[model samples]
Target: MSIQSILDIGKSGITAQRLALEVTSENITNVNTPGYSRQTTIFQTSFVTEERGFPLGTGVNVAEIQRAYDDFLQTQLKTEASTTGWSSTVLASMKRAEQLFNEFTADGLGKSMQEFFAAWQDLTANPQGQPERQAVLARAQQVVDQFHRINGYLTDIKREANQSLEGITSDVNESLTRIASLNDQIKLIEIRGARANELRDQRDLLVRQLSEKVGITYLEQTDGTLNVSLSLGPPLVLGNKAAELSLEPDAANNGYYKIFATSPGDNTAVDISSIVGGPNNSQGRMGGTLQVRDSLVNGFLSDLDELASSLATEVNSLHSAGFGLNSSTGLDFFTAPTVTSGYSGIGGIQLAISKTADIAAASVDPVTGGTGNNLNSRAIASVYDKVLATSGGNMTMEAFYNALVGKVGVAVQDAQRSSDLSEGIIKQLDTLRESQSGVSLDEELANLIKYQKAYEGAAKLVNVGTEMLDTILGLIR
Candidate 1:
């Protein structure tokens, strides 16, 4: 080989080794950086020449730097992330609702119901006393107030869930736009035969974040761009462009939102609300929130309505049939709904009799062919045990409410267990992913030493080439 060729080989070795050292240094620098994938320098032999019957080897060339990536592992991570997000969200809200209905609390519904019935029993003992009559009114009002408070709190919880949906949608949109931009940048760099490792890492991190908000599927195209979409719906990002999701008010309930995804191919927005868990099962936070608002909170409110409506209906029926202190008749203890159906029981119910004397404690008055008795008062107190049709079978109001509370407790426990399981799965997947792609400082430090020695050796070869060239020049002179 010519001396000039020998010099070129040494120069190439020096450059390749230096680049390797630089990559090792970068890995060490970003060891603690989140979502930073470890990169390795790829070395390729430069062009070879056929001399006589043998090929002369050239020094190494620094090829593209490759990131440690596993597509299947990343996909699994995204799925687990979505699951964890969904379960955690549901568990948190369910726990919050459970705290409100805690039977251990003094102002709980069960306690109020008990006190209300006790007040009626007190009035049954002193049927002719005004103070006992006032106590019944106060306790009755307390019961209604408890119902209203629970209904109001549940409504507020549902509203908060809906408000969070807007933020989730906005975050999803931002991720889509950022992914599209990264796709463009990655494609540009890759087309020039370079690896955009950092960009790819950033894009993958965003994809995981997006998966937490809503389930997503992604594909890595040959052109170094990612095509992303909802797991069960339309494409969200394709090449350098991204499809947008728009929120419209639901037709059935204007307070809720119907989400639509617009595709670039057809430019038509398709309603994906159901598929995304609007009223269906979901694997992400958005689905969890919808479940809380539509199912959990709504179910509790319905039970409260049934309890209030049934209790009021039976009490008013017995009280109205009797005579009050002033010989008043046809007066309801609690206002009954005019319609048979579609009544929001707790919200619509009120005390029909404002005056304390209006309470119908007499089934008959003995003075004028009527008995002034406490028979009706005792009957009204017994309404708690009256197995109304709303109780679903022969269960009393107290038994029905107890069952409801027990059901909510069971639901909360299930949610918490699911969240814990999801977290465990996500933790395992994350550890596996980190082992594969995450930077290891110890490994990088070891690599730094090896590359440093190789760099030094390559520099010595360049020095030898310089010495050899100088010797050849001395011989020619």
Candidate 2:
């Protein structure tokens, strides 16, 4: 080869090696960086003409630095990761709820109910005893207090869930805005025939993050922009624009929250609460929070009210049929009162008995018109047994409360199981992606050695060319 040609080859080789070295260095530097894709320098030979045909030189040029990635695999990983994230969040919240309602705990409602019933049984054994009457009243008060405490805890949990939803919504909106801005930037870059791969990575990362707060689906538009939506059909981010979501008090209940979406064109409000409440396997933290608020808490409170009502009614029926010793007339030992659904106030029916009933002269069978029987102890004991034997003697109010607590424990266990499974899946997917896209220090080191050798060979070529040229000049001299 001619000296000039050789020089040209050496120069191209040097350039290629330098570029390869730089790429290897970049990979090594980003080895610990999260979500950083390793880069590789693409090389191509320069074409040359021979005597009879085209010839190729040993020189090389860097075509481009390619980022290692598998688009389809990344998409799958992101989707799975999002689902795992949401399930984990909801599981944590549910676990907290379970702990709050633990029936096995010392201060739980189950224990309180049991203690109340046991106290009633003691009082029933000696209905005319002043000490036993006071004990019954005290136990009854404790039962009411326990209900109040449990209801209060449920209210607190609901309130906290609502607050968490609000925070998540704010974060989602921020991410949407960021993604929209990224869309605009990526579109502008793509319009110039440049691939905004880094920007795209950033946008994808944001989408994954937003998905954890509320399940989302996205589509890539023809313009290389993204359109995002919640599990519901409403748009969240469209191309270079984003929609705003706001929380408002539910029409039926001022304390409850309803979700609304804003249109980008004119900022018109659209109610999305029903849509959000629809059946969806893609429900995120927000949906779980709503379920806890509306269904779990509400159901427990309803059950409590039912138990209270039943107790009052049954006791009142027996009490009203028995005659008081102080008077010839019969009086109710317990009064039934009206209860409102979803109401948390403590102003309901109070269990009270006639304090003036002469225990020695009270009649158990007023229907038989008997008097001076002093059967008050037997009458009270019968009422207590009936209360304990309601629902086919299988479930007392105390047992019912215990069952409710057990249900909460089971729910928490189920949530934990789901969360663990989802987390494992996410980890597996992440490991696969990292193996494909993540930088490796050992690979970078090997590339560095190869590039160093190529650089030295190119330098040696240039040196030999210079020496040969100098020798020829000396011969001419």
Candidate 3:
């Protein structure tokens, strides 16, 4: 081979290896940067020439700059991010709900109910004592106050979940728009036969964030664009256009917010709450928040109202049947409930009689003390052991209350377990992804050394080729 050909081959090798070294350096620098993928140069042989019908070897050229990645691994990460986000949100909300139940604590409903019943038991001892009647009234009021306090706290929990839902939906919409813009950039760059490796990484990062807020499914098109959609709904982003999500206040549901999605090409926005937070979905942060507000909180409120209504009805029934110490007949101990918005249960629970003399301690109109006239107070105390009206008539008031609190505890445990399991899966999948796509300083430093040596060897060959060319020209001159 001619000395010129030798120089040409050496130059090509130097250029390719130098680019490889630069890529290795970049990997090392971006090792800690989020969403950065490791890259490497792909080398290929240059075109060959024929001399006397035999092929002459040519030097190598860089085919393309290829980034290290795996499609299936990225897909797995997105899916698990949605799942983990869901359970984590639910676990937090349920923890707040558990605090209100306070079944095991002294300041909770269990303690108040026991004290209220004990006051009635005290009344059975002195059928005509004015002080005992006054004590019973005080205990009943405390029980009523506790029910109001717990229900109010539960409403606040539901409100916070709604606020979180609003924030998550906004974030998901922002990510969708950004991903669509990245799709346009990637398509334009790849069309010109260039690698948009960094852009692809940025776009993938946005996709991961979107999935964490709302579960989604995305597919890559032939032109390297993505079509993104809700997990069970229509397209959210198509090519270069993304959908905008907005929430409308639902008048039918206590003016709570409902989600709506509008694509760039479509004027009408589709409501996606059913697909997102409905019973079909068990994914994403918004889904978990919606479940807390709509399902768990409401159920607890319903059970609490039943307990208050039943207690009031049972006491008033027996109290009105007996005669008061003042000889007044048919007087209810507890007043009728006044209906109110969001709280028809415990809002109007007040004592019916104004004075302690109205205490019904006799079954007859005139009680002369030694008769069996304390029967009405005894019946009122026994209401605690009776089956709750809404416990399917199988469980007593105390047993039913314990079960209601137990339900909240069970919800918290299930959410925590789900969050933990999903997090374990995400961590394992992350390790696997890092092995395939993430930058490693140790691996990059070794690559730096390898590429630097190849560049030096190519430079030495070029130096040798130049000297050999100089000697040949000197001889010819």
Candidate 4:
């Protein structure tokens, strides 16, 4: 080979080593940057030529920069992020619901119920006493007030969930648009035979954020664009276009929302609310919110309504058959429904009688209609021990209340357990991903040393080539 070719080879080697060192430096600098993948410079030997009967070797050239990544691991992370996000959100909302019940506090419905029944028991001791009757009325009002408080709080929680759903939908739409824009940029760069590594990493980070809101699945196109979809429904992003998400008031429940996705191309809208829960639920933060509003809170309200109806019906029945101080018969102790359908549950229950003289405490009256027998009051007091209408009549009022509170506790515990498990899985997956794609300072330092040696060796080779050329020129002279 000619000395000039040897010099050219050394120059190529020096350039390649310099680029490798630069790439190593970049990796080291970005080691702590979130979503930054470690990069490695690829080297390729230049084309070889023949010198007489020997094959001559050319120096190295920087081919391409590669990022350490695993597609399978990335997909697993997205799935885990979605799950963990759902469980954490559900656990938080359930805790709020549990707080509304407040079973451990004195102001809770359970205590009010016990107080109401205890007042009735106190009335049985002195059925003729006006003070005892007044106390019973006061306790009854407290129970009704508690029911109203619980129902109102549940309504507020449902409203908050609906409002939050709107916000989440907006966030998801913004993310879809950004991801679509990134897709366009990435495709443009890749079409020119260049890697858009940084753009890809940014897009991936956005995808993980999106997964927290809703479960997602994605496929890479040949032209370096992604086709992203909600796990159970229509595509969210196609190439450079994104579908829009919206929320509308639920027809059956005014305080909740029905989610929809609209295709940007054809302007087609599809209701996706049912996908929030059921066998095909996506199981993300949005899904958890819907479940809390539609299932958990609503269930508690229904249970409260049942308890109120049963209590009102039982008291009215026992009081209706007795006589009051004025010998007034068939006077309901509490308000009775005008219709034969009984009390209209929690919201409709009211004090039927205004005067304490209207409280019926006697089963029978003397000839003068002045008897103050305490039999009816004793019977009303026994309502607490009797199995009131609760869960097909197997539980008393207090037992049913305790069961309701217990159910909430169980749900919260279950959600927390799921959230914990999901968090552990996410940590494991993240650690694995870091091991594959995260930069290592020690590895980068080693690469720096190797490239530095190569640079020095190439410089030495160039010097040798220069010396050999000088000798040749001297001989020629």
Candidate 5:
């Protein structure tokens, strides 16, 4: 080769070696960086040819630093990851609620109800005894207290769920703003035809996090921005812009919060409670809390009202139909006003037996109470049987509550199963993505050795060219 051609080759070789070293160093430095893809420099032959176009001399030139990535596989991974995240979040929250109810536990509400009924059975054995009546009253009070405790617990859970929703909304809004900022940055970076791979990874992670808070879908726009939406069909974030969500007190019932959305531009409020089904109507932990509060707790309250009404109606009716022990007077043992329906509100009801009994009329025996002429304990016993019968053989408010709690167990199990299936699908997708884009240490090490050898060879050529030039100068001297 001529000296000039040799010099050119040496210079190009040096450049190729320097570029290779830089790429190797970059890969080693970012070895532990999360989501970082390894990059490799492509070297092309720079050929010197004669007029006939036949290649004579050649050296290497660094072409492009290609990023090891698979866009299609990554997209698939992110989608399944988002779905898995959502299901897991919902399942966790539902499981927490299930633990609160503890349906099968001996100390749970179900057991408390059973004890109340057993107490009632003891009272029924001796109706006239004050101790028996007092026992019944105490047991009845215990049942009421248990109902109120469960009701309070349900209310607390509902409040907690609302708070969780509010927290999630705040998180979503913050994430949306961050994503918008990143979007603008990515657009600027990509304007010159360079891929913002690291920035894109950050954005994908954020999107996955956002999906867990609510059922969400996102679309990539033509301009390289993302459009985000909730399952309720409302836009959460649009491109580089975002909408805010807030909670407002319900107009009809100030106790509950109604979810509302506000635009970023003008802050115009749009009610989203109906769309998302409010805190209680949601399908996850929020839904479970709502069910416990409205249906489970309220149902128990209704049963209590029924028990009180039935007891009052049947006992008062029997007492009014016959005379007391006093032959001179005929009066009811307990009287106020009869409740027409089991659903009637509890008001103006009191339990009291008449103080006086007429013993003057001798037509009836006092020992064995008569139906019409004397005090009839049999009448009271018949009414007690009616109360027991109305309870559907269980005779206690607690028994009814236990039955309801059993249904909650089935719901929790279903949610767990769904979450497990979703997680499994997500894991499979993740493996596929990792195979496509994830860095392999063995592969990277091999690449490192190859690049190192190329760099060394290139540097050697530059050194040889320098020595030859020195030798030519020495010969001239």
Candidate 6:
């Protein structure tokens, strides 16, 4: 080989080795960075010349940097991330609702119901006692207040869950715009015969984050761009452009925010609340939050209204028929509920009678025609045991309320199990992804050492080439 050729080979070798060292250094620098994929330098022969029917090669060329990526694994991770987000969201809201119904609390519905019935029992035993009458009035108000308080708190929880819809959609929109921008950058880089390894990693991380906020279906195009869509329908991103999601107040949902998707070529937006918020849909965090708001918490409120309404109706029926000690008749002991359905079904319930003389504790004596007996008071207290049609037609008001509380507790437990299982699945997928794509400090250090040695060797070749060229020049002179 000519001395000039030796210099050319040494120069290319040094350049290739230097590029390889930089790639290794990048891996080591990003070893702790989240969602970072390890990169390796690719080498190729610069050229080949035929000499005496044999191929003579020049030194190495630095080819494209190869990024470690597995599309199928990443898809699995995104799916699990979506599931984990849904489960955790539902679990947290259910726990808060369960806390409100705790039976040990002094103001809990169960405690109030017990005190209410006990007060009636005392009034039944001493129908003329003013203190027993006053106790019954106090306990009745407590029961009514308990129902109102529980309904209010559950409504608040549902409202909070509804509020999350805005936050989640905002996050989803931000990620979509960022991903489209990266797609633009990635396409530009790849068109120039270079790999955008780091950019691809950032885009993948955004895609995963998007999945956690809302479920999506993604497809990678031949031109290195991602096409993303909602789980149900509506394109979110196409090529380098991203669609947007906006929240508008929905009249049908009592002023709750509804999600709307608008594409680039379309000015009209589509409402996707039912598609995303259906109880059977398992899309992502928004789905879970909607389930809690519209189904779980609202369902508890419905049950609460049922218990309060049934109790008030049954007691009023008995009390209005019996005559009071002062001959007061046809008066409801508790005000009647104005509505038959919804969370406010019990809102109008209160003590209809306030005076101790106003309580209808006496039943007209069968023969004496005197209103001095305790039969009506006993009957009002027994309404707690009467199986009302409002309460599934087989259980008393008390049993029905207790069963409702139990159902809430069970829901919390079930949600916790789902959350735990989803998180565990996500953790396992994360470990697998790290094993395949994550940077390892020990492995990076070893690679760094290897590249450093190669660089030293290339430096030596350059030195040798310089010395040989100097010797040939001296000989010619």
> Which segments of model 1 are wrong by more than 4 Å?
47-55, 265-267, 278-280, 338-346, 369-372
Give TM-scores for every candidate, taking all chains together and pairing residue i with residue i.
0.93, 0.84, 0.94, 0.92, 0.71, 0.95
**How many collisions per candidate?**
8, 0, 0, 0, 5, 0
Worst 10 residues of 3 by lDDT: 337-346
Model 2: per-residue lDDT, tens digit, 350-406?
655536442222445433645434455355444433535433245656566666667
Give the Cα error of residue 97 in candidate 2, in Å. 3.2
Clashing pairs in 2: none
In the range 1-477, model 5's lDDT, one tens digit per residue, is 666677787778778767776766776777667666667778888866763566575667776777777666655555555455544554554565455455535655455444544544553444334564455455545534554454455456556655666676778778878888788878888777766766776787677666555556678776677777766557877767787878776657436676677764547788866555444334333233334333444454455455555555655555555443444334433334445332223233343542434211212444455423323434444443332554446553334444445545565676578678767876786666566655677776777777678667766776777888899999999
Model 6: worst 10 consecutive residues (lDDT sum) = 340-349
Q: Between candidates 1 and 2, which one is better according to lDDT?
A: 1
- Candidate 6, backbone clash total: 0
Task: Judging by TM-score, tell me the better candidate of 1 and 5.
Answer: 1
lDDT of 3 by residue, 1-477 (tens): 778888888999999999998888888888988878889889998999886788886788999999988889889999999988889998998898888787635788888888888888898888777788898878877887888888888888888888777788889889988999999999999999998998999999899888888889999998899999989888999999999989888899878889899976788898988888987685789888888888888888877876776777788888888888778878887765444233423455666777777877677765555544788888888989987556545788888788889889999999999999999999999889888889888888888888899899989989999999889889999
- Scored against the true structure, residue 83 in model 2 reaches a CA lDDT of 60
Predictions in order: lDDT: 0.82, 0.69, 0.84, 0.83, 0.57, 0.83
Score candidate 3 by lDDT: 0.84
Model 2 poorest 10 in a row by lDDT: 358-367
lDDT of 4: 0.83
User: Model 1 Cα displacement at 5 (Å)?
Assistant: 2.9
lDDT at position 307, candidate 4: 74
Model 2 C-alpha lDDT versus the unseen true structure: 0.69
Relative to the true structure, candidate 6 reaches a TM of: 0.95
Candidate 1 per-residue lDDT, tens place, 405-444, comes to 8867887898888888888888898799789998888888
Give the better candidate number (3 or 6) by TM-score. 6
User: For residue 329, what is the lDDT in candidate 4?
Assistant: 78
Model 3 earns a TM-score of 0.94
RMSD from true fold, candidate 2: 4.0
